[model samples]
Every structure is written in C-alpha cells, then in structure tokens.
Target: MIPIPRTLGLTPEQVDDLLTTADRAPSRHDNRPWRFHVTSRVIELYSVPERALPVADPDGREQRMACGAALFNLRLALHGHHVRPTVTFFPDRSRPGLLAVIRHGGTREPTPEQTRLLLAIPAQRFDRRPSGATAVPRNEQHGLRRAALDEGAWLHVVHDRPERALLRTLVLRAERLQTADPAFRAELATWSARSGGVPDCLPAGADGQESIEEEPLMALLTSHLTGTVAEIQVGQALQRVLLTATAAGLATTLLRQVVEVPHTREELRRLFSAARPPQAVLRIGWPGAGTPRHGGDVMTTATVP
Candidate 1:
C-alpha cells in the first residue's frame, strides 16, 4: 500500500474511500480490467490485459473504456476532497500500460456542479426493464449530452423512427451472435453468476437480457478517433453522461450488445459519425418507482507503483 500523506487535504481514510468508489465502475463481462498505482501526490490507472474478454472485445475498446471510467471516479473523489487534480491522459508514450497520471494539486472547495455529479456516482445503475420504455424530459436529455462534450466526447441521440428500427435490428443480430458463442456465454455466466456475498460481477439477479421494448432516447458515445487513448477519454465521457442522467432522476444502462460486434459497430459509425468512432451506446429514460442503484468492486489486481 502507498503511504497516505496529508497533502491536498486528504486523509488516509479519504484515499481508501476514493478507491472504493472507483472500483465500482462497470466493465465487460464484469471483468474489471483496471489497477491503481497510488501515492500521496498521484494516482495512476492501468489496464490488466489478463482480465480482458478477447473474443467479445477483440480490439480492447471496452477494456480501455473501463479504465477511463475508473479514472473519472478517482478524479471526482479527489475533487470532493477539495483537492485540485491535474490529469494527463496517456502521459507516458513509452509506457502504454499507464493510461493516466492524475497528480494531486492544491486544495479548494468543490463547486456545486461537482458536488451534484459526485453524489450521483452511487446511483448510476445497469437498469433493464422487462417490458415498455420510459421517456425523459427533453431538457434533461440535453444536459446528459452536454456532460459528454465537457469530457471531450460526443453523444449522438438516435431518435428518428427509421434509425431506431435499424438499431434494433442490428442489436438483435449482434446479441444473437454473442449468445450463440459458447465461450462468450460461459465467460459472462462465470462472472455474472454469484453464489455468496461477492459483488464483483454484474448484479446477481440480472438475467443478461437485451431490451426489445419500444426505444427511449438511445444515445451513442463516440470519440474523435478509435485508439487506446481515445477509448479512455470516451470512458470518462460515458461515466459523466451516465452520472449526470442519474442525477436528473433518469435510469441508464449500457447497450453493449450492439456495439460489440465489429461490423455492427461500423454500421453505428456510419449512422452516428463517419469521422468519430463510437465507443458506447446508452439507453436513457425514467426508471421504475425505486429502481435499485448498481454497486460493486473488484479484487485488487495490482497496487502502488
């Protein structure tokens, strides 16, 4: 463990709390392919390739996206502690494993926006409705899109009836391919199936079902380019959008089934943007009365560097 220092007004207990919050970010097949190297002054995030789902995520886009989400939580936690964090994505060209280097800067009080967004972190859940779709207020939808832009990513809302129809067809086909693959289903089942009190995987009760109901505001998050660094930025944008939506009393779930397939992803790229690469698609709407928030953490794969 890295010795927790009193710098930046953060106590050891606060640092531990930050780590706990970051560990809850979602991942592919619940394989949290992220590790942290922390010190009093800095926190570094890295990807653990061993934890990746090669067949389902052959290009490792989801892997980097997972690390990006973790990085966002770390920054938010530090911000809440009144510590200014200087972040550099892909700071070291020589060390590709080091996705980000977040240095703790001077102490200052968090802004109202920061506080509200931070509060929404724990409420962001993988919501799945058995039937029917709920609608979100138009203003709230704009706020969610703004959150992504602030993080240097794009959220393309698919609303046209024709586009929604195309998306449904593409998602159904991709999901069929994934569900038919023995290895993919085996891996998903292994991580998602919980027997004890373990909470490292997807919610224990979730039946890994794709939503075939009427579409709500389906948005795709895209980056300027499709690369390792770009994917990390996309992840940060994704979390920001999801948290902002949750703060606005909306339930959000990632639509990975559509974007996981390479060919389908190409189709999405053409639909959303020919220039930018789509990293994730999110389903946004009003949740049921008292929908449960998602919360989980992974076993520490590596520690302080």
Candidate 2:
C-alpha cells in the first residue's frame, strides 16, 4: 500500500494556491461557508458554521454544496499544477464539519476535459435570460444527464407543456410571495446590494431593470433529502452539474423564486415523485455578445507565511 504524503513535502505557498482557487467556486447568497486545512500532501475541507446563511440555507444544504464545489475546484487546481488528487469524502464522521480530505498523488497530465473546465472558470456567469435559442440538442442534453450521474444526482428536464405550465405557475407565485414578504425582501435586498448600498449584490445592470423572461425548457435537481446529510449531498451534486455545464460552454442561472414557497415546493416535488426532491431550478443558455455588468467581487482572507 502507498503511504499518504505528510505535510513535510508540501510548502505553505502551494497550499495557499489550492485554497485560493477553491474559494472561487460559486456559492449561494455569496456566503462562502467553508474552510481549508492544508498538510504537506493533503488538503482538508471543513464547514464554517458562522458563515452559514440561516435564512437562505437553514438546513446547511446549500452551505455544504458550496463547500463541495470548492472541493471540486481544489481538485482541478491540483491538476493544473500537474498533480493528481485523491479525495475522501466525509473522512471523519465524528467531525461533521470536515467535508473531505484531498491528497496529492501520482502524476498525470490534465485531460482536455479538465483543461477546458479550468479555462472556463472565469468566463462562466449565471445567465438568467430566456435561452431563446432552441432547446439544447438531444445529444448535449444526454451529456448533461451523464455529468449529473457522475456526481450521484439526477437532472430532469421539464419538457411537457403541462409540467412546464405547472412550474411557471409555481415560480410566479413564489416570486410574488418572496417579493411581498418583508424578511425575504430584506434578504434579497441585502444580497442584491440594494440594502445599505453595498457594492457586492447583483447590480441592477446585471439583471437589467426588466424581469428575465422564463425559458420553455427548465431543469430541476432532485436528490434524496432524508436529512441534513442528504441535503448536503444534493448541494455537492448541484455544484458538479453547474461546473460541468460551465465546462460545456453553457451558462446557467438558478431560479429559486418558486421553490422558496411551501406550496410551490410541494408542486415541484409532485412533478418529480420518482426523485428525492427538487433542490433548484436552473435555466441554461448561450449568453449573447454583450458587456456583462460587474456584480462586485467576492471577499477573501489571506494568511502569509
């Protein structure tokens, strides 16, 4: 058996580079609820309880998913550095916050697929506009399904008219409810940067003054939601799907308005009874040529050795 590489072999600068790349993973509400512990050859991902968004992610499902996304990015970064990463999920149950432990292993050249994904990291943005173009080609859609399976999740596309109508209704209702509720509005305002005039929220320019039109084809992610554990797994899978989409040169935006409401949530679940439960509704498309408005940058903390 090969012995695990200890901390003595890896330098602080290399570990810092891994953590920095991992931090770039897209997260809900811009709440980066994760931490990193680097040894010589292993990097451990842990959850930061204080960073959890209680209102938006009460069960910490999104939080864990955010961390999982980071974990995935870490793997990619290692590949970029010409190192293969070996990862163990939930390495220690006694320490629930410890999400995964990744170690540098045998050398292998980054695959074309990995290189494509790495290059896409900066260009990918959440596209909320109606895809307008025809539904994704059947072959591409099948490819997406396989990507979801790679992460242990299922992606169901809403193709039928009745199901699409039902989803549209649920989303409209949820949007109304969320816009009406003071708490929800406040949260949105906070995240949207409307509150306190913070520069970090999605700028008015990003969404434009007009509402984003809904696309005919939408996708919902469902996973077993047995408890908080299942929710986290769903989140991880969600990140995988999003990253895979990015790699495929597609843009995605999440629509949580409908699923935020209890009634709409139930309606969504009913639409996909065979799956666990829908975690998010995603709209995918090719972003037309246009100047993207800046949405502000993510906050990060750095420690110098």
For model 2, residues 255-299, the per-residue Cα lDDT tens digits are 666555667788789876755557777766554345232222111
TM-score of candidate 1 versus the correct structure, residues matched by position: 0.84
Give the TM-score comparing model 2 with the true structure, all chains together: 0.79
- Where in model 2 is the C-alpha error above 4 Å? 1-11, 194-216, 224-229, 289-305
lDDT, residue 134, model 2? 48
In candidate 1, what are the lDDT values of residues 130-209, reduced to their tens digit? 32255766888789889999998888888887777777777777777878899887766665563222332212123422
Which residue runs of candidate 1 sit more than 4 Å off their true CA positions?
Answer: 1-9, 130-134, 194-213, 289-305
Using all chains and alpha carbons, the TM-scores for the candidates as numbered come to: 0.84, 0.79
Candidate with maximal lDDT: 1
**Pairs with steric clashes in candidate 1:** none
